[model samples]
Target: IRQTFPSAYFIELTVRQAHYAIESTERLPPAHLITWVLPDYIQFPFLGGGSNGFSIGVIPFAIIILALVLAPSRKLFSFLALYLIPLGFTLSIPPFSWINNYLPPFSHMRGNLRWMVSAAFPLACLAAASIETFIEKGIAGREKIMRRTARGVAVFVIVLVFVTLASQFLAPRLIGNEDFMGKLVDFHFRGRTATLPASHYLEVAESAVRDIGNQLSFANAWWVIAILMWVGAGGFFYFIARWRPTSKTVLMLIAGAMTVNVFAVFSYQYHNFIPQEIMLQTPALVNFLKDHEPNPRRYRIMGFLIGDGMFREVLVHSPMPPQELANMERELLVNNTSVFWEIQRMDGLEPYRTLRHNQLLNTLINADKAGYIFDRENPNVRALTLDRVDNRDALRSVTPQEKIKDFLLQLPLLSMMNVKYIYSLYPLQDPRLTPITIPRPASIPVNIYLYKNTQVLPRIYFAERPLFSKNQGTEFLLEIAEVNDFRHTTVIECNDCVARPVGRGQPPKFVINEYRDGLLSVNTETTADEWLVFSESAMPGWVATVDGVPAKIYTANYLFQAIQVPPGKHQIEWRYEDIFMQKQKALLEYLEKLFR
Candidate 1:
């Protein structure tokens, strides 16, 4: 929004286009962030084309609607009208997007589909109100009216259960995509993360999922189990409603029913809580990257065809699959790229990523004398399906071939990230791989082969001079990244005139040394005016000091940190402390992700 929506007219046009495109989940408007909100590009027949919970077991939604219709009240009605109704219609359809486009958080909230959560939230209120209304009129002794609505609903539940059970006896619709195991298989297969098919996933120690049925098992199981749970909850609620159960019992009944409902929905999900060993035991490669302490050298390892899932695709999913989760852990364990490598999902783009790295990631790699320089013709954006809403210029334009080409381009550039061992099914004979040191035996029993790169750069090192650009856009930085000589010097384009030959900075004097705790300390001496850089993702809050005075930290070489120091012995410390985020909210936010 900051970039493209510079003017109200632009924001309005963008929103209007999105409104027109809201129905088409795959081709969402405002470009680039196609899969911003919804998990799936092709929206299903659920709300906003996709829904919050199991479609077959969504009794609460129906009950909420029914309650709203039967026991309407202005107080409750306001929430529906002011929040849920407008939110749903505006997000689902589009002229209403202006509210989202102009409003505070809404203005910045891309991923048009995320509004689905907002849509569900107000309905939840309505659902609660609906239940309360029923209690007040039928069950509560305070009301003069005496209606056996609960018992009636209980009878209705009995009929519904009977029909459901009867329906089960007949052939099911058998939509084989119950758990979408095949889709998982297809993702890994295409991404070249695993050596075997999805059937063989997490095979080590015999994952229970393998024995769930077979490689190709499941058919409408989501509905079958969901229906059973819904009936039980519905019957339980109905019984309590009919008996005019005490107020306390009513609360208990609702809580119990909701718990069962949630669990029933959970049953539809692929079983989690699998042993981590089941996922990690298969790859012996991680053993090589043991307890690697932080150092100036890059310890990062990026696997191309090494894991069993696609890194780019999995980021969109919350409570991501065990397969993808396992893959992500390995990305950190090996310090690899070519996957969604962020520690936590960013609400918006960070500065180093936006200004320095985004263009490099998108720029297509070319095998020039410069060895894997950026290709102007075909940008390496295969991995970046999400548009860089932070970049003023990065509108989403993905061509069919660019995806494949970009994926291919990333293979050679693994060395750029200091990857020691390269994993792939393709025969490894690239020019960049020529400098890598292969294992002595040079052969492994696994389906995939691993090659090592010897010329990999350290994840952290000092730069001689920054290849600065006055342009705010990253295009110049990307061109600099392509230059053979610009290896360590390609920081953000800057006007700072400090220049010198590349001299590696010494390890800081251990005055108070720390790393990755979001706090960095350095008590060291500098001989001359120079830059200190580290292989750390740059973001705000990295406050720096030179002899207890403030200093500037520049985002250099795209994905690292850089700071200039004068010729003098001085103590320098940098700490990434969030001013607003407290421990309780952060912990709660982390906990909330587990349910998803």
Candidate 2:
């Protein structure tokens, strides 16, 4: 892990700091995090209804409370539950907040609600122990009243479980009905019509209706199948209870109930399953992009789908149908779909990125937010538009004009990263970007416009002049972003390395001999010593060799690899190899040979 991510420690520290800051700003009330007995009313309305808005649900809460009251090992289980569940929540409170401030490892933890996940095991154990104790006590005792009460309690629990299962199966179908949805719309929109004009109100209402209907339709289907499941559970429970069943028979009944419960939940969760063939079907836009840029390694593409935080705020609140939203999310090459298309993409959903790369991206995003516009005529000079207003209000209002104004693509930084093609649902108004005509796919509701970055740099280039930066913070990132001639000037993050002036000579000729995953070879002939900058991310474990001799790799342009070369034809090879990878390769080879 250390070999793969040289800056892993730094990245972790930075991420922890960022996470803490975000958590501080978006801190939930202590009661919200600690209230495991109640269902989250804001998130799970259906479940929350049973708790009278105090907890998640009454059924689950009752079981937990019963376990606390009746468990044989109540003290130990209670201690574990109380300690684990509240540990994360208390970080936000006073005395415990000191742990977050002083303790480095503990401070790094985020997502306070996740602690409840760990507490689940103890809770489950407690509940099981309580139930077992109840049964054992009733069987061992001589009193008829106690035995009768235990049997009654057991029967009640069995009935409740089956009833809950039936509800799970039936609720999806009943809620999905059009009439029911209309009622829901009415309930939500009650007393709000007086604030808006008649036309606008109608538009909003229609959009809301469609959105809710689409969500229900997508979430649940196969009403007949659900009905069958409900009937099956009810019939099985009835037959089992009616007969004087043996121990084996009762066990089978319990096992069947467990299996059905699992099946119902799994089926409901994965109801949105599309066939493999349908999911992997290449979109027309992807085909177009592939045809134009045959070699994905040379350049990258970015899709302005509803993925970016700012962009999502505008599009999500724009009263779009849920189907349209789903199409945009699944169909667009936003996250990892670029991998399937065999095309390089800069923007992706990743757990963590290199500190420098993340900083550069954040800097560009901030610049766009601030309305910092780069000159179309001269790439070096940039202008800030103070007249630009914040789109927060516009997003809330959700007009077409406002939606368009919300996004200012960071074209300059994107160009530096070798981003050639940018596709978006809405057209971008940038002078530097030229629009390309492509027929929109019929399935897609919105029009997708492709823009060609005119100022995109080559994947590999030589720079005679080197701008050395002592600082590796936001200041350095800003300096890198402000560079006009990225191809001619390279920014090196090194305090000791000597800065070289721009040499007066013809540019060096270079040929990419070979390029593949984890390996790159290039032949270059330069008139003078210059820095060879590769647009690939400068990650750890990547070793460079100049004519079979080891050479140092320096970080360039805040995120790429840069190495110095003298005036001669040299074969430079870069291979990413780590101890863990080598061991895995050896193990695989051994296994293959042994099998043979």
Candidate 3:
């Protein structure tokens, strides 16, 4: 957080690891998709990548992109409107991302795809402008460019379809005689699981492709479809060529029929989207823990997917749930499958503490990742280590590595934070882990397993004294605390905590009075000064009042909340106040109301 980089959008916690924001292959051209329903996009929810992995905003995208190439005049405006603006947000390069890196709304953007989505309107307008210019004043020499362009577009699209259909017709013979699923299974992927077999989802998905077979075999119908598109384009252009009272009606009919054709082609693209909150299926373990007597302890899950925008229960410690993040990333990043985990929310996840809470959350993780954690940044993948000193900002690389070493290297800190369980897709055979036996659910393609740690402590505990350090980084704290039993002696540099009274007149007595999402009340009886620590992500908003008087809330254990209380019976209450989240919620509500 000390300085910013040009590629800040790529590494921003909220939008990082999100596939759609970083990858723009999905929005390339309509030529890539059989479904041609190109919807206009003005804001986030840019899940352009669809079942085809290239589906989002195809229609308008194709129109905008093609207009730039096909149209002659107003090229700079077209370039700025269609190319510069959209890419300025999506690309991390100098000339492209200049606006995003400098602009206020663009800075700390929720996702890059949202920027591209913003360009959609301007690009559409550019296309419209070109159409109007051509219809009214026509390009010099190429006066019939509009009519020619329409006919050319139809022929080009028909050829593209013919090529695509040809590929399907010959795929079986060229690739393999086996069924499509068989070929897919045999192909190796690029990341850690690349050697591992393809997910069953791939098989199930490829099986669902509408025209997987030789569309050429149905050549008669294919030709008819192509003819219809050509006729429609020809008729639209034909009417524009001459003004008449009937032209408007004829254009409307052609446009309506074309819309139906496009919709029919991609009818199934949107047949399967259910909002995550409404489609809640609580994890079995989550349900069990919620029902258990000792339900105060929080746990973390890690596996094939961590934070799904549609599934909130999967990730703890994060104010924004998986589904919530997904909705944001998919829309804003324009990648439906991408998930965002933004660690630096200006709106507080919790109350502001007596101490400043400006630190980013990524410094704590020790990820040995595969795909996104490319090896180029850290050449020796085995030696890829994340430390607070550097924030180990290597999580944005796209180069696929076979395996990421010790993705959960922060287990020591997590244990101290009261992470009781680890839900992982692969077996974590690390020394500190113990497998929790459970029937693997059929929902996920990979085998989902759970592991437990015996060393993790309770959510609330009394620490002997704060281990002071000049470096308040997460990795540094863990390194210092590991020497002693971290449960009793944790590290922090906050000046609010001092050692317990020398004589220790009497061990401090701790009792919980009341607890809620944003509030904690504790009754403490202590004859000696002691530090009372609560396991939770700390921020500036969490203030403490001991015996109805204000006290400093220390940033304890590198990431938790704590306050020192004097030797006496006292009621210590902590209240949470997050204005950012409030504003975000209010804005979201207003937006929903406006849209609704």
Best by TM-score: 2
Per-residue error at 246 for model 1, in Å?
Answer: 11
Residue-wise lDDT of candidate 3 within 1-596, one digit each (tens)? 32243234224323222232222222333232233332221101111222222223322333344444556566537545564556544545656455544554454343454555565456446545544443344332242754565676577656756755675666555444335646554442323243223554244334333234443234545434544554555555544545432434543553465465556455533434447663244444444444542434344333322332123232222234445544433322222121132111121221121112212223224222333332233454234333212233444433322232434444665567566666544556677778777554344323456677767767677776566656533345335535435665766555443554445666778888777778888899988677788877665457689988999876666667777788889998988766455456789999999999
Q: Model 2, range 404-471, lDDT digits (tens) per residue?
A: 44434455677778988877766688787899988776666566788888988888888657788886
- In lDDT terms, how accurate is model 1? 0.45
Judged by whole-model lDDT over C-alpha atoms, candidate 2 comes out at 0.56
> Per model, how many backbone clashes are there?
18, 5, 27
How do the candidates rank by lDDT, highest first? 2, 3, 1
lDDT of each: 0.45, 0.56, 0.48
Winner on lDDT (1 vs 3) = 3
Candidate 2: residue 114 Cα off by (Å): 3.6
What clash pairs does model 2 have? Answer: 38-55, 38-56, 39-55, 39-56, 39-57
Off by over 4 Å in 3: 1-84, 91-94, 102-105, 126-154, 165-231, 238-245, 274-278, 293-411, 428-436, 442-446, 472-484, 495-505, 579-596
Q: Model 2: residues >4 Å from true position, as ranges?
A: 1-10, 13-67, 74-110, 116-120, 139-260, 308-326, 366-409, 497-503, 579-596
Q: After aligning candidate 2 to the native by TM-score, how far in Å is the CA of 514 from where it should be?
A: 1.4
What does the lDDT read for residue 118 in candidate 1? Answer: 57
Better of 1 and 3 by TM-score: 3
